[model samples]
Target chain A: MMRRILSRPFAPVLALAGLLTSLAVAAPIYNAGGGAPRAVFLELPARLPEPEVALRADPLPSGRWRLTLAARHFRFTDICVLEAEAVPLGHAHIVHDGVKLAAAYAPIVDIGPLPPGRHRIEAVLRAQDHRAILGRGGLIKGAVVIEVPERAGGV
Target chain B: MLRVTSSSLKSGAAALIIFATAPPASGHEAWLLTPSEIEALALTPVPFVFASVAVLGPAAGLALLAAAVALALEGRWATIEERASPWLRGLVPSLGAAVLRVGLAAMLLLAATGGLPRHGTAPWTQSTLLVPDMQLSLAPGWDILIVVQVALALILLLGIGTRLAGGVLVLLSGLGLWVFGAEFLSYAPHFAAPGLMLMVIGGGAWSADALMRHDAPDPLTGPAAEALWRGARILVGAGFVYLAVAYKLTQPTLLIAILDHGDFPRFGMTYDVIALIMTGVEIVCGALLVMGRLVRPVALVILGAISFLAVVLGETPLFHANLYGALFVFALAGARAPGPRPSRAAWRMA
Candidate 1:
């Protein structure tokens, strides 16, 4: 039986089958818990461009403020292909006074209901996975200050 | 009994690994089609499918070992080829052309009506160019280009001036690529396939060009025609399958992530669920092409899906190439053979 299995014709097939069987039974191993696959991470190389972000703010009568964002050397995609996270394509995250706001899909976004005071707002472009889009120029960021009047039924 | 069961289990696992890795890694680059975009996806968690495949190395080895035994048992390669030749010849050009032609028309219509980037203002369209000044000026030109493209697609769909329309599409795509630079060169295969098909067939038998010239010889009659037609259908099918499995199934992170970008009309389904459905649709379309069943309509639907995807995700060069090629093929090879449709031809052919 061993001789028959070791023959040229059966050897390759046996080897292939053996390998496949092992693959089916073995569990996946990773260096980090729930981290990226090793092969995928291996393919990633450093290729960065100077991506810059700018912000423009306007107040609307409907008790909400609109924020417009622009970026140079970057583009945004509605869907983030995690495999494409290294690329300079992602949406912007709005930061109001150090608190994280919603993600901005387009160049313009509307933000809301502020008390009578001045507030600082910042916009940062993030990668597909919600990480910051950073290059040699550092993180892509823009900031602005806006004033809002108190509501009619203010506390 | 236990030994036998354990052995079978191992064999199954080995085969699984081999099957999983057989397809090439070409599809994962949907996002990384350009050099600059490579880093964007590299940092994210590996797509689940890819990650799974990556860990199947040992099984892959055993699968390779087992393939030899299977192949030996299968035997008589010449006999198999002889049996398949007639089927291949019958299916290639005739059925293949019909499917491609119809697919092309639907895709053209979609592009003309704004399913894809007929203009230069879109991110994928403009991303090809690094020059900000040139990007600004390209928008007006793109507007004109869209109109012209629409006219050509309509003409092609009607089977009028098929060759001319195809030639122009090739030129337009080429010009676009030239402007976009080498970053998009890899997409040439998809872009050029249709133009080459049109040029080869000129105007198909059912086309307006043929009707105008009664004496025109049938372009798909030669022995080589069989291979050509079969190749076309297979190419389209393979492309679809690749996109469905590789891009959608393997790289679903992007699709899921995009859900947060905007409100999509999902008809009560979540975007993630919708994405799976779309993937299933793509696979079905691809399978239809491979089986040469409902070629025209399925191709058209596939084109529409591609168009919709292009619009939402932005048309990458890959998307552009697929759209361009599908249009060319559709114009040349209409939905079905140019006579009373045979109801069970695809089944018979299979």
Candidate 2:
């Protein structure tokens, strides 16, 4: 029955117009036009020395996990700028279980006494412009999966 | 802090802004998440976003300027069309139809097979529809929809039941909207425009439909048919405009990210500058299409641009199979109609 109606040439015109209209009517409202947020990425230029990074997480006493970032040819800077840096260094995006947890300005990061379960933590090397720095093998970063055993008091 | 308010959306255009605002920045995000990016993108806070004054002001200005220039060129092109006889265009009359059929067929085939996934992912694993976002997994009765989609693709290929296939194309576009809602906005118009075009033109000279027809064909000549074709062209143009604004202008991060991902070489220019220029050119091309001015050139430019992206990004040509065919028709057929065509917007104003 639907096919029969669709077979008509006019049906498509109406349907498409209707769809377009519907979309325009239901746009997400943002306080934009004055200032809409734009993501700016600093692309690593060709022939640049690629920086590499590795992660090592140690469980601290207070249920806080301390992560030590071991990086090569890349410096972890405290400079919070939106421009491309002179060298491949800015900060790191510490992702906890798939969500962006925090931007680590320095090498070491202390993450939460996360809920008692397994957590997949990833640290991606980011340039000054917040782009995940890319190397030959792919994103110049490191990741590790950790399991948080249930504490005595279920805390 | 980005403020998202539903109260701002009193009309459809307002909603379009949001729809345009919320696209993921690039294939890089997809790489990070391993193809879960599309799902993640729908949960937009700040992904590939750019509706800022810096970008939109210039992009919108470029579109307006392009429309003005195209309106001017429209007169000269019409004169050239009246005088110069292009032998390849409509010479066979069915060649355009045949080309369109084959192009759409290939796209549908790729989509049905997931031969052309939107993300740089394993084929047949993610995409099973015309565009990347319209995942078959998201739709209800997708199992049935896939069969219908594939069947339509086959029919369009064979040119056995073309008008019916075109009709199905329209329905499929509608179905995308029904299932995916606003997310489908970028793709729906492009698909439906061609679908309507196919319906109007039928399967040109080489199609099985043409073979079956005993009487003289009357598909491309009439005033109504010509108007529909013009309308279809405008719709295609508008789709381009929407994409240019929504993706490139508003959400420039994605474009930049993709360019960066491919290590798109800059001729001593920053990625931002290059991104701005690309956005401007796309707006111009889309505006020309909408104005029906310099259509052949516009079509060629679009064809070249999409082809370049596919090659540079290492994507399959079949990803934009529909566009290739539609552009081919425009390049060959030109914008002139067989009969008395509608006047330009300027002429009407005069």
Candidate 3:
């Protein structure tokens, strides 16, 4: 009677058992490849230091210059540049600084070649609404000397 | 009977094992992570491994413990069962069934208030249909659903309208399946045992369904009828587990992902391993449930497996709703009085 009781339920049980055993033994494998590229990582300080700027100058083959500036702790929603000579501050254009090229809110910007010589690059931080100067006034400034290496082989 | 008892003991041991192995909840016991961590994990995808295990482990332990206790005390004379008048013998099952229903409702309520609200808009109150967009709109018809679910829970708990209540619960399960989509998909593999058990078995000896049967002729009183009912339940349970395993096999990445994440510090190695082990255990339990050799033991294992998947996996709200119904059936299965005498004519037909 006990055997009969136990035996009655075997067929379905065995079937399920077989199925589970097969799955466990087979064990699935996943392809680790085929995923997206990593994004650039930036580490910014919680608050920027006061208005300090640094610059590097690269001379292009066309004799135009690219000046990259890094400003420390200057916060702005938008960025703009005014020619050093034209500014109301009466600050003299240091030297051969040219037309303002491009402006950005982040610490980096590129300004170009006037007559290649010593020049002042002024970076101004502006408000989001574009109405006012960011801090006490409109301006933060940095300067770099650009000496285009004279072309060696060119006529 | 010995086999059943041994199986029960084994399940109880398994529960104890899981309970002992699980880590204490994190100091940061917040259900959701901080925004910074969310962003980082989204980019890295490493944290999910630990998080999944941590959530699933304790739930498994609790579920197993519940199953063990249920199995151990099954058919044993308890105050509720003994005091129940012969006429109210059916009430025993009804009360157990009620507990299952009400307890599930209570758990869902707690989860909705405590956890779900933090992540996204409440399903009932949210209007926007898009789940991922974080737009919160109350689900259309949510009020009626909640009201009816709560009412059914109350009726089941009160030992009123066993069959009709069970039927409504079955329907609710279907509705729940529709609304919760992906949220339910994560726990889809674990749905079979309880889903089948409840819908097929109709609350055992302790349910209102059984109580109603007592007053009326119960077809379930017959050995053949009882066997057939159990058989149907077993088949459903087995089929669910089989399908889940088969589906998992097709998606190897999920298994690999689970394994890769196994080393996460918060989830702990022991519990993570156990979670993986449970996948196999469930498949075996489901098979055993269907085979019907050691009905009691197999049922206990399946119950424990379900509990582990639900509680430790932290999927209680999603699956517990169905568990309420399944437990009602389990309670009845465990509560059969030791005789062949038909309690009512209805039982004979069943």
Candidate 4:
């Protein structure tokens, strides 16, 4: 009888049916759920390096002011920073006259034509998740004063 | 007079203040980096050349290091196992299985609770859908699905109707994959494999099914049950091994990036070397699990590591799910229950 069952073409079908029946009788549990979102990481200033930023702006031949930024106590990874936490490894967000400019990954960045007046350019060190890197005092930021001289033709 | 204790206390207080008030900073987006990007990061020259060297050696070097450790401990491992077996063998397995069942049931209940804002969390509410296109929508027959999910979990937890629960789980998981498309396959295959395995084994001797059988002899104790257990083990083991290789070994740049993100490099240790060491441990543990060598110990170690990562990397629900799966593997491997002979009705069809 066993041989007959094994030899039959419907053996696969029978086996599947039995397997399904057994499973049905013995109910099991699985994981398909999600969990609440929480803060990714916390960086204490004691463990953090005193991040410093220096900014330089030079008039380019193309008429745009080329801004060069040198950051100390920070690292950059083009890798996604939203999920993982790394200390001191993050990008810099540039701000001009309190208006948010752009997030920069590289040291050298180009700034478009600024109005001929005194302006403040700030480089703020940010964590990988885009939160501003903070010290006990306040945000880790550096500012440089730039004077955009009036062009050859006065308005 | 300046005392050493006073100086230490001052520094400790300063450190405490720093940690207590520090605001959490945003980190990287959750995603896997490509192999090439990782390679580039590993080879990138930095001022800390020595640190880079520590992290940047060939994979063969790691393999050799592992082999050396194994060879050194070869003689003692057997003796250690012999000594530990009597005490460690009996209690851990059964307890681990019960925990696994409860954990799995809880996760299922959470999933069954349906999508957000009702679920009120990303991992729970958004877990049922992946990408915008799969269109499993938050509404519709979610009520029915929740009812089924709760009923099945209760049956499985009681161990009274495990086979039925397993069948339903298999069907549900299958349907989930079909609806969610192949993208979500990587997320929950571990849950599905164990469901089928339990169906074959009839929830072992500790279950209500066993109590109902009441010395009638468990048909699952036969060769078929053994095969099912082995299959489940292999599936889990293989899944972990693949992750170890793909995420840790082949593309350690990503690991380095994560370590760097954690500010691990500040302690004068090379993140690259740290990455390599972590990868090596993952590979060795994963391989041991796959080969069914020292299964209980390996599972425990992997479980510990994963739990730690879940906390350190971020406590996502997915990580919690993985933890439950590891616990199940531990139960399956450590269990040594006596079961009665198979009932004729079970094998009647054959």
**TM-score of each predicted structure versus truth:** 0.44, 0.60, 0.42, 0.49
Candidate 3 structure, TM-score to reference: 0.42
Query: lDDT per residue, candidate 3, B1-350, as tens digits?
Result: 55544443443343333223322111111123322222232234212322343433444344444434544453464444444324343433344445555554453343333332323224344222111111122234454554564565466555455445645644554554466433232233233333233333345455555566574223234564455455445544544454334332222223333333333233546533443444545545554454443344454555565564445334434424544444344444542321222356535434
Model 2 C-alpha lDDT per residue in residues A35-88, reported as the tens digit of each score: 212333343666777777788888877777888888887888766432344468
Q: How big is the positional error of residue B187 in model 3, measured in Å on the Cα after superposition?
A: 7.1
Scored by lDDT, the top model is: 2
Sorted on DockQ, best first, the list reads: 1, 2, 3, 4
Compose the digit string of candidate 1's lDDT tens values, residues B77-108. 43553454345333323443444455555554
Off by over 4 Å in 1: A1-155, B1-44, B47-54, B58-99, B109-148, B167-176, B182-187, B199-206, B213-217, B221-350
CAPRI verdict (incorrect, acceptable, medium, high) for model 4: incorrect
Error of 2 at B187 (Å): 0.8
Candidate No. with top TM-score: 2
| Model 3 ranges off by over 4 Å | A1-17, A21-155, B1-95, B104-144, B176-219, B222-228, B235-272, B302-321, B324-350
- Model 2 clash tally, residue pairs: 6
Off by over 4 Å in 2: A1-142, A145-155, B1-70, B83-88, B214-218, B336-350
Which candidate should be chosen as best, given DockQ against the real structure?
1
Across all candidates, the chain A TM-score values are 0.63, 0.67, 0.36, 0.65
RMSD per candidate (Å) reads 12.0, 14.9, 19.6, 19.8
What are the interface RMSDs of all the models? 12.0, 14.0, 17.8, 26.2
* Lowest summed lDDT window (length 10), candidate 2 chain B: B1-10
